[model samples]
Target: MLDQQAVDAEEERLRELATALPDLQRQQYFQQLKRELRDPDTYAALNWCFLAGLHHFYLGQWQRGLFNLLVFMAGLALLFSPWPWWGLLFIVLISVAELWALFRSQIIIQHWNNQIMRRLLQEYSSAE
Candidate 1:
C-alpha cells in the first residue's frame, strides 16, 4: 500500500512534469487527443487492434505481438487435436492469453486517454 506522503509526492512530480512542457507542444498534444476522440471509427479501429493483440504493431512492439499471435495459433491447433486433455489445456491457455491481452490493451488505452485529458485540462486552466 502507498503512504499518503508518497502519493502526494508523486502528484507534485506529475504537476512539475506538466508545467515543464512548452505551450506549442502541449497544444499539439491536446489537438492530437481531440482528433482521436472525435473520430469514432478511427478510435474503434485502433482499439480493435489492441483487443486483438495487434496494437503492439502500432507501438513498434512487433516481437511481443508476434509471440502472442503464435501462442494463439498454437492454442487453436491444439484445441482441434483429437486428445481431449490437450484440447482442454490449449483452450484454457488461449482464454488466459485473450484475457491478459484485453486487460493490457485497456490499460494502455486508458493511460493514453488520461494523458490527453490532462493536457486539455491544463490548457484550459492556463487560458483561464
Candidate 2:
C-alpha cells in the first residue's frame, strides 16, 4: 500500500497536470473564439460539461466529483417519473437549476486553472 505522503504527493502532481494548459495554444484558441463570438461574456463562463464535476476528476477528486455527477444524472432521471406530470415538471425545473450551478462551478474552476497556468508559464519562461 502507498503511504499517505506518497499519495498526497501524487495527488498534487495530478492536480497540477489537470489544470495546466498549453499557454500558446490555449491563447490562440481563445483568440479565435473571441473573434468568432463578438459577445465576450457569452464564452467567459465555463462549459456545463466541465462544471458537472469533470474538473474534480481532473484534480484527482474522483469520488466527490463522481458523486456530484451522479446526483445530476439522478435529477435528470427523475424528470421521467411516471407520477403526475406536475412531478415530472418539478423535477425538470430542479434539474435545470442544478445544471446552472454546474455551469457556474465549471467556469470558476477554469478561470482558476487559467490563472495558475499563466503564473507558472510566466515564471518558467522568465527563468529560461
Candidate 3:
C-alpha cells in the first residue's frame, strides 16, 4: 500500500546522500545496511510457499508473523474437527489476504531496507 515512485525516489535520495559521505563513513553505512538488508526473493518465496506470514518474520516483523501463525494454527485445529469446511475456509481466507505480499515483495523489502538505511544515517549524523 505504498507509492512505488515515492519510495524509489526516497531510496535514490538516500543513496545520493550516502555517497557524499567520506569513504570511511560511507563504508560503514554500506556495511551495516548489507547486514540488515532483507532479500525480496526470499520473502516472496516464504509468502508464496507458506501463505502463513513467515515472510513477515524474515523482515523482523514478529507480531504480524505470530498473529498469522496463530491464526493458521487455529485453522488447523478447526480442520481436524467434524466441521472441516470451517477450517478450510479460514485457511483460504488468510492465504488470500496474505497473497498480496507475494506480488509486492520486492517493493516491500526495499522499503524495509530503506528504513534501516535511513535510521543508520540518522544515527551516524546524530552521533557527530
Candidate 4:
C-alpha cells in the first residue's frame, strides 16, 4: 500500500544518509564523547544502551532529552512514594517508549543526519 512505499522510500533515504559527510560532523559534536568515539549509528543506539534521552542529547535536542529525563526521574520518585501502582504504570510506559526508540534508532539517526547534511551543505554552498 501507500505506507509500504513510504517505508521503502525512507529506507532509501537512510542509506543515502549513512554515506553523507554530516554523519562525520555529528560524530564530532560532543567534545566529551571524543570525535572518533561516536558515530551517528552508535549515538542512536546509545538512546537505549544508556538512557532513553541520551541519543537526543547527542543530537543536540535539549527539550526532548530533558523531557525524557524528567519523566524518568518523576517515575522513579513515584515508584518509592505512595503511588506505587502509578509508578509501575509510568515505568511500563517508559519501557515501551524506550523500546520504540531503540527499534527506530536507525531511522531517527538517518533523519537527523539528513538535517545536518542539509544545513552543512547549505552553509558550504552559501560561502562559495
Listed per model in order, the count of residue pairs whose N, CA or C atoms clash below 3 Å is 0, 0, 0, 0
lDDT of 4 by residue, 25-71 (tens): 43443232233232657775676675647777887779988887777
Q: List TM-scores for all candidates, in order.
A: 0.46, 0.32, 0.95, 0.66
- Candidate 1 local lDDT, 31-76, one digit each (tens): 6655653332343455355443455555456897677566656666
Which order, best to worst by TM-score?
A: 3, 4, 1, 2
lDDT of 2 at 119: 53
Off by over 4 Å in 1: 1-16, 29-52, 82-84, 101-105, 112-128
- Give the per-residue lDDT of model 2 (tens digit) for 3-104: 445544544664464345467644554454334322213322322444345545554567967776676566556656654455455545545654654545
- Determine the backbone clash count of candidate 1: 0
Model 4, residue 26: what's the lDDT?
39
- Kindly provide the TM-score of model 1 when superposed on the true structure, using C-alpha atoms: 0.46
What lDDT is reached at residue 14 by model 2? 41
**Runs in model 4 with CA error above 4 Å?**
1-40
Preferred candidate (TM-score higher): 3 or 4: 3
Clashing pairs in 1: none
The C-alpha stretches of model 2 lying farther than 4 A from their native spots are 1-47, 83-128
Model 3 misplaced stretches (Cα beyond 4 Å): none
lDDT (Cα atoms) of all candidates against the true structure: 0.55, 0.49, 0.88, 0.61
Give me the displacement of residue 89 in model 3, in angstroms. Answer: 1.8
Q: Candidate 2, after superposition: displacement of residue 60 in Å?
A: 1.1
Better of 3 and 4 by lDDT: 3
